[model samples]
Target: MSDDVSLMLRASRGDRKAFRSLVERHQQSVYNFFLRTTGHPEDAEDLTQQLFINLYRSAGRYKPTASFRTFMYRIASNLAVSFARSRHRRDGVSLDQMLDEGREPPRHRLHDDPAAGAEWSELEEAYLAALAELPADWRTAVELRVGRQLSYKEIAQVMGKSVSAVESILFRARERLAEKLEPFKE
Candidate 1:
């Protein structure tokens, strides 16, 4: 979004209102990116705040040589990697994190049967647990593609990989996700 770039440029020149505008326009998407990828609302909120601060601090250094969103997400991806590594180092939390309230199951069907709702809850839990277990890079790719609705090329740019690599990663990731969810596919 060129408008984002413009806002960023204005921010670089110490334009506070412009920065606020930029944050207003994209904070939710960025928050969602962190939330789905990290599977913890608290962590996601922290990460989202950190990203904006990081972006603001680096505003002067930004070059609009590429899509601003791509640049922004590349930074976000790095933060995700850092968060994963830190969690791995600090507490062995890499395997046990889970998505919560980041997505919602259909309410109508879920309420129709208490049994079905319980089953659906189990299925959703399994899916989140499986997603949390994926490799950080794979999870990042999945979040960027599915959650952010980024194109393959956009994902490639965000991840600093080739388009083919993005495609391959997403393919493998999807196959893995399908396998994890297969039992719930009735």
Candidate 2:
């Protein structure tokens, strides 16, 4: 059950060890995807756990037609969309409000930063904000393409779209990001 196909087969049949191995192999990538999509560490953690639970529940129906990663990501992406839509039904919760509420280290706190550190932090914040502002599809495409470094084909697979569609999303997303950062560069 070391190989993805075999592991999936076992997990599909209620093999806990196989499921654990699958989780170990892909949990970080799934978590990171959630973090980037939600822009909220706490939400990411919760979503990630839910993703695993969903995976386990769906394992019995798992098919080996594509790479396990692609299958897993498809589920994650769907769940993310559902979660966002659910949140939207309520009063719009800002990304900041949805993020983890954990306290930060004093040194990493913005007010404590030295000039260079402060500048870096500001740039990072701006970048993240820009990403958060993107349309959901574009943002998901960018995250999968750049953050996860998935190829256009892989992205298309995960998105259940064509390669051209994924490329178009990335192209539009990049243009929007550039526009957002233009003022900051000056």
Candidate 3:
């Protein structure tokens, strides 16, 4: 078995430092996943913390069948789905609205190169808007594939789907993004 597997085994046995090591190693990757999925730093912070908390509680059920990263991401993805569904059912607040609340309003930055800054700002707004228009599942796949740079296999593991399924999701997502951006591009 690998050293990480051993560390996870120790963590499963309630070794605090072992768990801490796992968190230290994986937190940024997990956080980036949440941030990209939700497009909100604040919600990502809450969800990432919740993911670790769930991990701690779930240690007893840990199995060595998959890599630790895959297992942790599966947990994170499930948590994100559950959180979104519950919030939607209970409060009618869409994830987009929550993310909007989390975003800082745009401010004009003083730039020596005004034309370049204007172009950048336009592109940023267009990209963000296009991303927002994608269906949730497709958006998640795109975020995991492009933003997080996870392989199709790793994304499938995280999403509890097959690699082919992940590929399909990413393909459809890219098509939708292209459609959404066509107007702005032209």
Candidate 4:
């Protein structure tokens, strides 16, 4: 059994420390998944908290049928889709708004060159904007494959799609992203 499954089993048996360990182990990846999906740090933080809470509540129901990471991402995917829809109705916010306000942590300056840092920042911003413009399914597919480093089959399980469908989504998503980013190549 995987470490996550072991931790989850312990959590199911009311082991608070095991639960906490699981939370610590997976929180950053879950947060990053939401951050990239939602393009808002606050939303990502809230969603991450919600995901763990839901995981804890559902621990007793968890079976080791799938890898725990895949299972958690499936939950995250559903939550993110619901959150996006509700936020869309409530705020009518566009991806542009999210991108404009989304601030990434600064990378270490290369040779202490401010100009290089600024350029990289600008490119990063543009890349994010392009990502946000993708269809939600495509974005999710790409993020799972690239950011989360899931195998295609794993991504398929998370998205509840066939592997071929995931492949097609990723192919189209990559083509679109490349089109958007082509101008940035130096």
- Residues 91-183 of candidate 4: C-alpha lDDT, one tens digit per residue: 244445644667432332222355665666555755776777677778888888899999999999998999999999999998988776665
Root mean square deviation (Cα) for candidate 4: 5.7
lDDT string for model 1 (58-81, tens) is 999999777888888999999998
Measured by lDDT, the strongest candidate is 4
Estimate the overall C-alpha local distance difference test score of candidate 2. Answer: 0.74
Residue runs of model 4 more than 4 Å from their true location after superposition? 89-121
Worst 10 residues of 1 by lDDT: 104-113
Give the Cα RMSD of candidate 2.
6.5
After TM-score superposition, what is the CA distance of residue 16 in candidate 4 from its true location, in Å?
A: 1.6
**Angstrom error at residue 4, model 2:** 2.7
Report the backbone clash tally of model 3: 0
- Which prediction has the highest TM-score against the true structure? 4
Model 2: number of backbone collisions: 0
What is the TM-score of each predicted model, taking all chains together? 0.80, 0.80, 0.76, 0.81
Instruction: Find the 10 residues in a row with the least total lDDT in model 3.
Output: 103-112
Candidate that beats the other on lDDT, 2 or 4, i.e. the better one: 4
> What ranges in model 2 sit over 4 Å off?
89-119
Q: Number of clashes in model 1?
A: 0
lDDT of 3 by residue, 1-186 (tens): 877677888988989898898888888888877766665667778999999989988888888887776777788878766765565322234434534577422322323356754666544655655665556667677877787777899988889898999888888887876764565453
lDDT of 2 by residue, 41-156 (tens): 67788999999999889887877776787878888888877777677422243333433343221222222226654555444655666677677778788888887888899989
Residue pairs in steric clash, candidate 2? none
**Which scores better on TM-score, 2 or 3?**
2
Return the lDDT, model 4, position 159.
88
